[model samples]
Target: MHETDVAIIGAGPVGLFAVFECGMLKMRCTVIDALDAIGGQCTALYPEKPIYDIPAHPAIAGGDLIAALDRQIAPFAPRLLLGQRVERMTDLGDGWIVIATSAGETVRAKAVIIAAGAGAFGPNRPPLPGIEAFEATSGVRYFVNKREDFRGKSVVIAGGGDSAVDWALSLKDIAAKVMFVHRRPKFRAAPETVAQLEAAAERGEVEMVVPYQLHGLAGDDGVLRAVEVATLKGEIRTLPADHLLAFFGLSMELGPIAEWGLGLTHNHVTVTPATCETNIPGVFAIGDIATYPGKLKLILQGFSEAAMAAHAIHPRVFPGEALHFEYSTSKGVKTA
Candidate 1:
């Protein structure tokens, strides 16, 4: 059993920032995450993708942004528990007890913060017959966490969303042959990204297959060799490929937190307007898992909410003493 002033459930950007914020307030923190590393989706989903709205830099890769954030919070020296999932939370009459399963190890803590952004939405695979068998043999990959693994391999990507297009563009120079297959002609990616992909296809850098869906997968020696696709005109065609990558966006699962009796709307924890406190006392929800009036799910907004939640907790933890204050450009006097 370990004790801490706060325990964050997810080690994403929001939760990592919360750890630093709490440390500045002279409070101890413990961060728990399901993945082997921190940075959550940024590191796991698309590390090579560039982000433009991070405030300080005009553009930064997802991996680099996470690294910078990790460096900023390193001085805090917060406890990090990776590959852990909170099974249940109980009120211990004094504070709270968080019971978690971390790589087969049982752990406990106080004051849990749910910062799980789009919680554990596993990869979406195409509805194709024999795909399961192919996947079991390592012929199909649903997530593109590692881009270099497909070097010199024939790869076929499915989906027109950001993830699919981004991976396609990133693998163009690495993979032996890269092909993008989308059910829609127009992409849901950014205009610039879509244009770049189109230009790549025009220059023979990549192949584009539109308005088609996968029907089946065929392989040799338990490894994918060809893909069967169904055209919009009800025609079937076979394409040779070494690997199949599906980036059909993710579907979120609320997990046991949804049954914790916390007030929720549309499967998201409901919180107060200014402070990120939930309906339950001493419990707060931040980042994408939290929802309030006019709440927009963004990294910057989550950082602000985490700060507010920490301030609100300081007074409750120490009822008599005057809480310390910090000057903020947006909000004048904030207690920590």
Candidate 2:
């Protein structure tokens, strides 16, 4: 059994920042994540993807942001258990809570924070036949973990979302041939990205198969040789491709949290904006997993929520102690 002042049920960026906030109040934290590594979706889903809205930085890659967060919380020395999910939470009474993980680890904490953003997630696979076969043979990939894998190979990307456009641009110079096929004429990606993609299409560096949808796959023994696509008007054609990159987004599952009796609105746990505390006492929710009035699912917003939850939980962790909040610049972090 492990013991801590707070048990955080996610090791994503928001959860990592929570450790910093709680540590500022001199509280210990143990963070648990279902992924084998920390950073959650940022690391798992789109590490190479660029984020523009994070404060200070004009633009930062997803993986870099996670690394920065990791360094920021290093002073806290918080315990991190990766590839584990908190399966059950029991009230031990007298302000103590027991959190049991799927990995057979038990943690006792004074408070709990449910920062599991979108819970467990998996790629939204496209509906093309034999897609799973291609997946098994490495001919089709949903997310790009490494751009070098497609070097000097013909690659066809399907989708109009940011992931599709971003990967197309990222892999254009590396891949021998890069083609982007989308169902609509106008891409759903950011304006600048769309402009870049359009310019690339015009320059002949990347082929644009617009107003077309993935219709079929042509391959031998699961090795894709070409991709069959159909226009919305029913015209069909085949595009030569060694690999198919489909960025159809992700399917989120709330998993056990939905059965935990917490008040939920459209799958997001309902929380008070003031403290990010959920309907359940001592169980707070933050980040994208939390829902409240006028809520914005931004990382900066989640950082603020983490601070709020930590302050709200301070009194419970140190019963009679009053928290004297101070800025990091005023009272610099002291490494434990």
Candidate 3:
């Protein structure tokens, strides 16, 4: 078992930032994440994707942001408990809370903060026969972990979401032949990306097959021969391909956190925006997992919530202690 001032439930951008905030108030923190590494979904899902709304940076890659956050909190030296999902949390009266993880590790802290964004997420796979066979063999990929894998190969992409459009445009120059098949004429990606896909289609670099859904997949143990699609009119067509990429988005679950008996609204924890605290005293919620009136699910907003939660949590950890909040520039990070 370990002990800290705060036990953050997620190690994403918001949770990482909270470590910095808590550190400023001389509070030790332990960040727990189900993933083997930090950065949560940002690192696990789209590490190469670009984010435009982070403060001070016009645009930054997802992985870069996580790296920067890791650096910013390095001085704090918060303990990281990764690869373990929080299994249970118990209030130990007198303002102490004990949290246990799936790995059987336990941590006692004065406060708990839930910064899990969309909770545990997994890609929504397409409903096709033998899809799992290809999935296990790398013939079918739900995400573009490495763009070079599709180099000089015939690729068929399914879905009409941002991931589908983005990957289509991203791999257009690398793949020998790229085809995008969707069930609707319109795409759910950004307008600019949709325009780029259209321009690529017009240039004959990409084949656009609309009003079609994935019917089946033709492949062997680990080899993909082609992708079969069915039109709305019941017409079936096959596209020869070496790889099939499906971007049907993700499925999110709150998991064990939902059983904690916190006030929940639409699967999100309800918190008072002022304190960023939930119905359970000494337990706070921030980032996308926290919802209040006029809440905007943005990274910057979560940063502000993290600050508020840290300030509110300070009093609980050290009873009757005066909190004189100072800017980082005023009193730079203090190293132990």
Candidate 4:
């Protein structure tokens, strides 16, 4: 059993920032994440994708932004528990008891913050017949962890979301034949990303299959060979494909913590808009896991929520200290 003033549940951008904010308030902190490394979904899902709305830089890769955030908070030296998932949480007399499961080991912590972003939500698979058979045969991939495996292979991606488009663009150069199949005519990705993808399509680097849904997967000898698609104009076509990648989206699971009598709306924990405090005392939710009035689900918004949560925890963790603090950056001589 380990004890800490705060135990953040996810090591994503929000959770990492929370660790630093808690440290600034002179509170001991420990962060646990289900992934082996930090940076959560940003690192796990779309690290190579560019993020343009982070306020400071005009454009930064998701992986680079995560690394910069990690560097900014390195001085805190927060304890990190990777590859762990919170199995259960029980409210004890004084504080809450969190049981995290990782590789057959159960670790306990005092206070817990559920920062599991879309990670808690498993991948959404297209409901196409024979798709399961192909997946079982290792011919279908749901989440792409390594891009090199698909090199020189004819790949078909399904989905109109950011993940699907970003991956289509990322693999355009590596994949011999890349095709993006979306049920909708318009994409949901950033306009700039959409423009880039359109250019790739125009240059014959990628093919766009609009207003189409995967109908079935065909394979021979337990390996995928092609896919059957139904287009919007009542036309069905079969395309040769070596691999099928489904990035339709994800469905979130609140996990066991949802049954802890916490107030929730639409399966998301409700928190105070300003403080990020939940209905339960000593329990706070941050990042995409939390919802409040006028709350927008963005990494920048999560950072602000974490700072507010830290301010609220200061009184409970540290007796009567003033909560005013500032982050100091090292000065460098500039020659312009």
Provide the TM-score for each candidate, comma-separated: 0.85, 0.94, 0.91, 0.86
Tens-digit lDDT track of model 4 for 1-336: 777788888899999989877876667778878888998777876676666678888777778888987886777777888887767666675655555565444445455667778437666777776667788866787666677888899999988877788889889899999989988879888788899999999999999987788988888766999988997677998879999888877787877667778898888888888788888777789999899889887888998888888888777666577766665344321222
Q: How well is each residue in 83-124 modelled by candidate 3, as lDDT tens digits?
A: 999999999887789999999999999999999997888989
Candidate 2 stretches with Cα past 4 Å from truth are none
lDDT of 4 at 322: 74
Please report, in order, the local distance difference test score of every candidate based on alpha carbons. Answer: 0.80, 0.90, 0.90, 0.79
Better of 2 and 4 by lDDT: 2
Q: Model 4's lDDT to the true fold?
A: 0.79
Number of clashing residue pairs, candidate 2: 0
lDDT of 2 by residue, 1-336 (tens): 988999999998899999989988999999999999999988987787777779999889889999999988999899999888988888777899898989999999999999999788898988888788899988999887777889999999999888899889889999999989998888778899899998998999999998899999999889999999999789998999999999888888898888888999988999999999888899999999999999987899999999999999999998898777888899997654
Clash count of each predicted structure: 0, 0, 0, 0
Off by over 4 Å in 1: 58-61, 92-110, 320-324, 327-336
lDDT of 4 at 169: 89
lDDT tens digits by residue: candidate 1, 1-336: 777778888998899888877766777788888898999988887776666567888777788888887886777788888987776776666666655554554445446678888677687777877788788876898776577788999999988887788788889999999989988789988788899999999999999987788878988666899988888788887889999988887888888788778898998899886778887777789999999888886788988988888887776556677975765454332332
In model 1, what is the error at residue 237, expressed in angstroms? 2.6
Cα deviation of 202 in candidate 2 (Å)? Answer: 2.8
